[model samples]
Target: MTRRPSPPQSTLPSDPILALRANELLARGRQLESQGKIADAARVSAELVNVAPDLAEAHQFMGSMAMRTGAADIAAMSFERALQLKPRSADLHIALAQALLALQRPADAARILDKGRTLHPNDAGIFRELGQAQLDLGQPDAALKSFSRATKLVPNDLYSRHMASALATTGAPNPGYVAELFDSYAGTFDAHLTGKLEYRVPQALAAALAEHGPVAGPTLDVGCGTGLVATTLPETLRPIDGIDISEKMIAKAQERGVYRHLRTGDAHAVLADEPDFAGPYGLIVAADVFIYIGDIGDLFASLAARLAPGGILAFSIEFNEAQGIAIRSSGRFSHSPAYIHGLAAANDLSILAEVSHPIRLEREIPIPGRLFLLRRG
Candidate 1:
């Protein structure tokens, strides 16, 4: 199982009266930030900086506030100062690397990340940022290494999932562990996935459907979260159906009125039960849904069996070129292009079109999104 790094403990002095005052101010600032009063938090953080200019914690807090407020330059300066004081802090290095990336100085970010890894080689967050910096610098090979290290260090991190996907662009095999990790996250899936991740699988599927013309009979939106994709379906295709493993997510999807049917069940098993679902669906769409399934052989085979002849299957996946599909300690599977092609061919599905593009997540990270339009032969 992938382990997350524990939250950092407060190291600031709690005994000295002056230090206690600074801690109080910092605590208040954090509360304000959590309450969405970023401006007020900044003001408090500024006061902390004045009282403890050499305090690494103070600088780090101010840096986070600046970054949150779109003050990238200021954030960088604050983080730099913090690093100078606490050069061993891996979290500080990650923050500084992010600020540098915001300023499009990936090379510099990579340098800091290297130093961070040296200090905290076992920290997954350091490797994640390092991998991201390498990717931004167009060093796919290096990025792949960093991401691989990150998954080993912190297999459960979703950031590692994104990093693994990015590295896959270099034709590296997909990381095998991502699927089960995602399946675990499926409980809180919609709440954590939408709005930020620019999860356009739903949108991409909609676009594919639009390009192909109307979906003919009943339709199923597999792994439909919050009904974002289901709602996008044309009204003519009423009685749209959706299925997901997370009951909480299915509830949210139902609230959107996008699907005539919504059920909480395994995607593969759900379709298997509905053998007659074939021909009823003019289209079957899975957006950003297959990343959690390590082996698409079963999924593709099941989908082909469920589709009518000439019926389309549109879905989104985070592609990887990694070899031999295997599950990682992280629980998600990365797919190789060969693996994807093999699945399509084995299932008797013809790939009509496939497009690769950047997918944005909630934290402004751009993940690679692969869209495939398949027709069952």
Candidate 2:
């Protein structure tokens, strides 16, 4: 998480003695930070309040240090104090917005970002953060507008452009956007998905794959977040390879120690670009990954070329009534059953089994999707 710029000594208390001391202490803190003495810097920042209680920069430094050390609650409190001292500071508002997001107060973060917009109407960074907050709150329409505003304000920033384009139409998702989105969710992903959301795609996929038989040999786990699917894999399938766009998710997956190799990139490209891959892959599994992928024709082509004869490709997809694929208002894609079956046949793959189930809970309501097992013919 990046913090906004700190105010200079000129923005501190008017008393010459207090301002000089605050500046001196701020310089020492910087030197300590440069030397990797983070705790010392934090201690110095804490002492600044005693000398210059009215200095917003001191509280800003304290907030930055707290955020650095993962004390989001403390960071929020410090940032709130800084904001109170400098109510109209755009930078302080942005800092507080980020802290609120870390604390799972996205609605509050959205409101603060709105405040920031009023202060810095032309600042693209404010719009970007506002878009993220809106998206996190499940208001994609609002997020789309905010992201569009960011792209308009910062035309040179490709990231904002990509996000706007991705949301503009139903097409292939922007890998960069999806990666960053999941990276932000990585810390709380497992708990939120399994605990309150009731994510059971992995368990269901494993059950279907086992019942289908020949569950043997190497496996490729696409979007294998935290290796939840790998836990149920047969021991014979040693050295599973997992591919995900998020580096943080890969880090969490590595903790499971079940994967032989894990890489960060688009799953389709990661699997397609494996030059050393000799024999056909025995099994390839994707649990709730395709939702981020709108059209699967390209992925099917890659799988048709690499999947072993009689080897199975198992995955889950959100259900949709659209004629083909549709990106939900929440920014997730859903595939029509007719679309999946049609694509499978066109790609020389035979559907082994397709089961309808509630994939997960969205706002505590069941989200229905289908799990399919496809075999290369």
Candidate 3:
């Protein structure tokens, strides 16, 4: 009895025409979005949702459109409906959690992501999202575990590795880690740093520079995140040039219309090798730049080479009281006063002025730091 294995079963909807219609609408909406007709794509998504209220894909499409349009509330509702229709779908769970996170409900997002992880134990994205949710909830230990798991799953993911490193409270973050961090953060950086963290490094550094009389030639802004230093400096220090690791951050800095030139690169390598950035410049400012940079010995040597005679090199550091660098749990590295003084002397740079101040706030607590103005002999 060669019982032909019963004909392969179909998973298509009972109403094939309706399923076809829904798929066609989804494609059209995606096409519209791809063509940059965002409003039209949104309207198509809305129509799809109405035509196929029971279709999980239709609701997901609507939710994605809402999210793209910054309608997090609408996105949340649509994703919830999608999740209801596809309870076991890992993508649906992630979508709902993202919507919840955007709504500032990290606890809720964490709950959803935890459930998603339970169901799909091997999903790296779920672990990554869960880590972010846990971090938002101030669960660093839990976030560390999640990020570690994600790193284990996707081994080469820089963001996961960096988050793990930050949580482990050790190791100098790699350049890739710093670039990825600021690129993703560039959008909200200015507001968050200035408003929430009460960052005043640029202002303080500018004040210090003003004391040195007038700076001559073009000034260089190192690790110039969003051109804050360029904007804060006096007009006398015009024709400013800036370099940063993150392209997105560089774009933001460019939008400020302050710098004569802006470059996206590791300041260490750029200053050492790039001819355009190489300058026997009058002033080089690195406001709050040393946090991401663990070792400045090489950087100091580079700065010494670039500085014109009597050129000023001004910078700030998260002040570590210990006699060496400390990798803080915040993923930032702090340097001791002794270390900076030693480095400056070794690099033939004389300390002009040193000011200890509260650079910014972390968790509403002021973080102590030091600003140093060094002069090339």
| Each prediction's TM-score versus the true structure | 0.69, 0.61, 0.62
Residue pairs clashing in model 3 are none
Candidate 1 structure quality by residue, lDDT tens digits, 204-227? 667777887655757778777667
Total backbone clashes of candidate 1, pairs 3 or more residues apart or in separate chains: 24
- Candidate 2, 1-377: lDDT as tens digits: 89997643326667898889999998998889889788888899889877777778888888988877667888899888888878888888889988888777889999999988998999898898887788678786887898889889887665565556666765556656677778989999999899878998898998898788776767888788889999988897766888888999999999999988888887667766766333367888889988877777887677666778887889999997764876553456789999998988888889999999888876346888999999986
C-alpha positional error of residue 311 in candidate 1 after TM-score superposition, expressed in Å: 1.4
Judge candidate 1 at residue 105 and give its lDDT.
86
- Comparison by lDDT, 1 against 2, better one: 2
Q: Of the candidates shown, which would achieve the greatest lDDT relative to the real structure?
A: 3
Off by over 4 Å in 1: 1-24, 50-52, 70-73, 98-110, 117-204, 257-266, 273-280, 292-295, 318-345, 351-358, 361-370
The list of candidate 2 runs beyond 4 A from truth reads 1-147, 153-163, 167-169, 276-279
Pairing residues by index, what is the TM-score of model 2?
0.61
Q: Lowest lDDT 10-mer window, candidate 3?
A: 5-14
Give the deviation of candidate 1 from the true structure as CA RMSD: 7.8
Find the number of clashing residue pairs for candidate 3. 0
Over 1-377, each residue of candidate 3 has an lDDT whose tens digit, in order, gives 68755432213245778778778998999999899787899999998877677878888888999987778899999998888777778998898988888777889999999899999999998998888888778687888899899999999888788778756754356558898889999999999899878999999988888886567768999999898888887777878999999999999999999888888988887876778887879999888887887767777788778899989999999997874676554567788999999988899899999999888886346889999999998
